[model samples]
Target: MLLWNPDMNWIRNPFPPAVLALILAGCSVAPVYERPQADVPAAFKEAKGDAAAAGNADWKPAEPADGIARGPWWHVFGDATLDGLEERAMAANQDLQAAAARLAQSRALQQDARAGLFPRVDAGVGPTRQRPSPASQGRPDDGPSQASTLWRAQLSVSYEADLFGRVASSVNAAEADAERSEALFESVRLALQGDVAQAYFLVRELDAVQALYRRTVALREQALKLAQRRFEEGDIAELDVARARAELATARSESLGTARARASAEHALAILLGAAPADFTLAEMPLVRSAPPVPALLPSALLERRPDIAAAERAMAAANARIGMARAAFFPRLDITAGLGTEASQFDNLARWSSRTFLFGPLVGTMLTLPIFDGGRRDAALDLARARYEEDVAAYRQTVLTAFREVEDNLANLRILAQQAAAQDEAVAASLRASQLSQTQYREGSVSYLEVIDADRNVLQQQRAAMQMDGERARSTVALIRALGGGWQAPEPVASASPRR
Candidate 1:
């Protein structure tokens, strides 16, 4: 206690000041938080019954999706190229990196708010000079204003009392905001990975089409050569030879179109990996692998799976906390400031024990401030916070519904596509046989060149349709994986409404 004066009295702090602050803080005015519930089913509808019989043949049975890692999900397709592309996108995509930066900012803000929970201390050492007015110095009006310099070396501490939970509410809001940012970052990452995989699969599907067309071109060339020979030998008419040439030209043109499509898909993939279209090239490889079974999770588990849902829920919580902060504005605010230092006119005397000074009191003696009237500003803020919370609730519910729709949509696609694939396989086989029979008849002069050409076209079309079905199955598989949050793992229990002040 360096404070000493004949007119001043000394007092001892009887209890820990921190404990007193807590006792006086009482309770927060913020409404108790409750996690808004969304309509959820016992199980995914697409995973059972008539809708699932054909589709889920390629799908794994429903399982508890909690605590499972969904990463490396692309491996299920058994495509190394897809896995590689996903890794590249994860590491280099600008959008994902930008989301990570935003998460960092949110965490920093949380730390800033957390600071409000504890006292702030500062130490300063400096010399300050000032000139006093003659009147202020109690001198005659004509007296000279003399300049004086003082040296000070001191430590100060300040803390705001959470009297009505204002500090607590601010901290809560910031924490929720940080949590939301983290979930959003995960959401961005999952979307990027899915996009890369989807694009890769599309490129491979195009490769299959390209290969199919090229084979047809070679066959058509052989047919044209045979027709020319028959025309020279006077076994077939000139019209037959002309038709064969036309078929060959059509095959060549269709092959060129497939090539163009492949190039466009490849370029899109390159951009997803954070490269210019010209700088990236994927090797031509056909999509031959079947899409594997993705775990069909129960609907309740979905609440913990989707990052977007998590983020939306967190937004609601932050808004709820803001309501409390707004309500606290109508209550008294208390700030405690204290300092211990030495001051002297001479720099050399600043360190002397006799020159010591101390103070412990509210800044400017403003011990408390309860809002009286501010043109209804506090009331408006409270209303605004409540409105925002309601808005977040609506958004959160919409997100849940959208998630459900995505899962159901992909599941239906996979089911119907599976059934279609089986039928297309049979059609392709029958067409190939028909085309072979037509070619033999044409060679024997038992059928016109028109019949052979029609049969060949049917075979080509059916084979292409089968290939397209395979691509659709693969695409639907990837889409379902994304809807399930890109992995089987479950998140931590969500923050729920509590009565804690």
Candidate 2:
């Protein structure tokens, strides 16, 4: 157990000189730290007007459902495969593992810094054989030498007297850096999760598109066969057969392209999940039709929820603490050292108390060092610290601005895409109807095969467009959630009772 003694006077102390010195070395000169201010908006710009009103009914301001775990925000998509992939990524992702290791390294460095506040004790023992020259007796120029074994054992203790807060300031700076590292780890984790989700969704979207193309290829092949039969039966021209075959080839080429895209997306996801591309595979799964409702939150909450913002804030604190450490270099430093040990020339008498010799009588002393000249080293360090603080402040503000922009951008995307999806749905239905009518009229000899071909192509294009829009809406929804900081929340403060007057 350690005791705290605020009083430094050693005159009346019953303890030894070493104890007194240790107790009085706690004074520091570092200034108190305060968080810097950042400019923030009352609300998001795009959160107003139609964007907010349009999705107001669908947006839920309450906490997410229990079935969808909060910290793993990807669970809200309700896809078991996605949830599994996220879990695997969190456990094995190399980038996240590296970030965690960095955090641990920072914590170890902080521990080393905190050790400066305590005394360091070390002990050592050594036995040596030495010969002494006898010429010092002045009896003869050449004389015999006497050999003896000497055993020496000693213990030493040292503590910095933090009289100017250099050690304390350094510790504070290290602690702040450790905290910054922790936030950075969390930032990396969030980014990894987001990347995995985005890549997975892309793969699923490509699957949907590829499936559409496959169906189109099959239908066009059938149409080609029908045109070939009609041309052989003298009912249609060779031009009709050629057009159908060309459309069929185009559909097949598109299907192959979509397959390539899906494969690329899958490979990207595999990398994010920390698996080899050749060894990893994701089964075909379609994206969920409806996007999970996003909870409404105040703009100020973003500052607290985003890990990157927290990291920036911690960086500013570290820089601020470093400034104090730099300032401390301009003042005097005090160190206290003490040693207690025994030395003996005879091995047989080494264990005996009478044979032990005290080197410096408890060996207690204080050292004060003042740098009268340093060629502006301290001043440069102070300037650098202040400059870093300013840089971190700028970065923090910029991060906040970028976060707001992302939220607004995704909100606009989701809103406009919703409208476009509705209109495209209607267009697809109309094209399908037109294709059916043209096919029937062609069979009844009321129109040329050209009308049927054009109608079929229009139907396929409209359907593909509708599917693409769905994929966009899903991707935008994921982006919006990521921008909202992925379900992070500040801890609730506990209420305390009022003190009596």
lDDT of 2: 0.76
Per-candidate TM-scores read 0.90, 0.85
**Residue-wise C-alpha lDDT for candidate 2, range 1-501, written one tens digit per residue:** 112233644423546776557447645556566766677778776675444554433233544221122355666677888889998998879998888889878889999999998989899888889876777656466777678888877677877777767888888889888877876776787788888888888888888888888889889989999999999999989999999998999999988998988999999998899999998999987655666656546788777767677778888888888888888888877666655555678666667775554332233433666788889998998899889888988998888888888888988887788789889999999999999999999989999888988998899889878877877877787788778777533222311110101
For each of the candidates, the C-alpha root-mean-square deviation to the true structure, in angstroms, is: 4.6, 6.9
In order, the Cα lDDT scores of the candidates are 0.82, 0.76
Candidate 1 overall lDDT versus native: 0.82
Tens digit of lDDT per residue, candidate 1, span 415-448?
7887788899999999999999998987788999
Q: Determine which window of 10 residues in candidate 2 has minimal summed lDDT.
A: 492-501
Show the lowest summed lDDT stretch of 10 residues, model 1: 492-501
Candidate 1: Cα lDDT at 277: 94
